[model samples]
Target: MIISFVQTKGGTGKSTLALSTAFSNHMNSAFGSVALVELDPQGTLRNWWNERTELGRDTGRVSFHHISSSQKEVFADGIKAIATHNDLIVMDIPGESTGKLHTRFACAVSDLVIIPMRTSTNDEAAFADNLYPIIKEILKVDPGKKGCFYVLPSFTHPKANRDTIMGYFTDILPPHVGCLRTIYPDRSVYENFNREGATLADYAYSVRENKRHSKQALSAAGDVEEIARAITQMLEKEHVSAKKEEATLRG
Candidate 1:
């Protein structure tokens, strides 16, 4: 399965979410070989992975790949090559600053396209102007992609009500774009967790002495796990639906 975290607008915490999701315990347990692929030319994740290598940290079940190619053919071929060996390919797609080339490509190829967005009016407007149009275009070309796109509420207040947040997105999102059941809450730990290529698990272990920090890390880790679990559940549902469709056609 291929899952992509994509946003046309930057600074939505999509990269961090992508990395944590790849490292999430749920993802590792569900997928045998997980490959985290970065399509950003800016190389945000490349730096982090380099640090991990310098620190002599092992990736274990998860491996990292950086594909900075702008050509769709090259990008698609690279992802396809990775997907052959890996059970899951989680992509961190770059924000479409110059153009929506990467965004469009990622959306079209991914089994699940996760858009990390905020509840702000500016983000809503940006999506309406930029990302939503791409989604609509894709759906027009292939209606089967109706269930492939989802919006994830990012940087939400930890104390915020889940139902209210999900409801807000549900009302605004278009027909084909669904809202995820889980939210990525804003936490101080997230800001500092990735320092020196450290994963959330590493950060939690490092801050074990501080009760408050440890608790926050635990909560953030839980959020990533929930998001990963939700993605896996959605994939399972889509798989079943596809099988039934095949059976019906055969009948």
Candidate 2:
């Protein structure tokens, strides 16, 4: 399956969520192998993978391959090449309006396109002005494939007013976009993971050895697991829906 985690605005945890989902799927063997495609020019996800590999070589653990490309043709070719070998491909897109075409192409080709947004007025406004328009264009190009798009609430503060924030999207987001039950809390584990070049899934065993620190870390990890499961379920349901659509067309 091809899953692209994207957002037009930066600092919304797009790369982190993309890498974390890819890592979680890889570790769980949910897919025989997973490819993390970094389309961001800043190369955040690419750098993270490189650092993880270096750490893994020193510590003896699995590391992910980072595919980097900014050109749309190059990006498409890279995705095609990686998909040949991996069961699941997760893409991290650049955060800007210039990449909207590429992002739309990825969304059109992907089995699932997850748009991660933070629960803030600014973030919500950006989504409404920028990301939502691009998503609408993507849907215009592939109307029959509307079920593949989803909006995930990420980096939400535990104490934030959820109703007041999410209420704005009531009339905006498409019906195909599922409301994720799991909301990723704004925590230090994400920062630590980015700084340490390790994912929560990557540090699970170590968390078991440390009690106090691991308590919060483990809780965050549980939240991540819930997010991953929610995504997996969505993908599975999309797969079934696609199969039924194909059958109906055949009939």
Candidate 3:
């Protein structure tokens, strides 16, 4: 699966979603592998991978790459080569539509595109004015692409007016837009995941740092599991559909 976490609205936590999804998928699989392609110039994911190595942790079936602008075509070629050998490749990218680097290619090739937004007026407006246009443009470019598109609500307030946020999404985007079943609350566990250089799946089994019983880690573990399951279902469905289409063509 080639999953890309993207948004045109900056600071909406696209990197967080990409890391969480990538590593969660990594730590759970018995034999499946994950490769994280960091297209974001900030290099947050690249830095965290370094931290994980310094901690003497098993980077286990996971690799990180920081792609520079001068080498986008090379980066794209590398990602395609990796995809053939890996079970998952999660691409983390900046939240901007117009960039000098080659992001339109990334948008075209993703198997799944995730857009994260916070529950606020600014984010709501951005989804309408920015993210929606980006998605629309991608479809225009690749009208026959088979991919899943999602908008995830991130950094949700505990006391947030849930209905109002839901209403805004329903109003701005068309109805029946699929959202991740779980919302990422503003939690310290997510903050500490990379700070601790571990995924929530790792945290669930991390008895060394008392992460196994850490209340914050424990709470977030369920969220990660549910999201992973959702991702798995989507990927499987897409594969099955593709196989059927191919079989029909032969018939």
Using lDDT, give the best candidate's number: 1
lDDT of 1: 0.91
lDDT string for model 2 (1-251, tens) is: 88888788877787778777766643355667676777766777667767766776332222244545555677677778877887888788777744676576677778888888765678768877877787777777778777777777777775556565466445456566655555767887777755557777556556777786677677777776777788888888888988899999999
Q: Which ten residues in a row have the lowest lDDT in candidate 3?
A: 173-182
Please give the distance, in angstroms, between residue 85's alpha carbon in candidate 3 and its true position after superposition. 2.5
**Candidate maximizing TM-score:** 1
What tens digits encode model 3's per-residue C-alpha lDDT throughout 152-192? 66787644565666665556654324565556667766766
Ranking by TM-score: 1, 2, 3
Off by over 4 Å in 1: none
| True lDDT of residue 193, candidate 3 | 64
lDDT of candidate 2 at residue 2, scale 0 to 100: 86
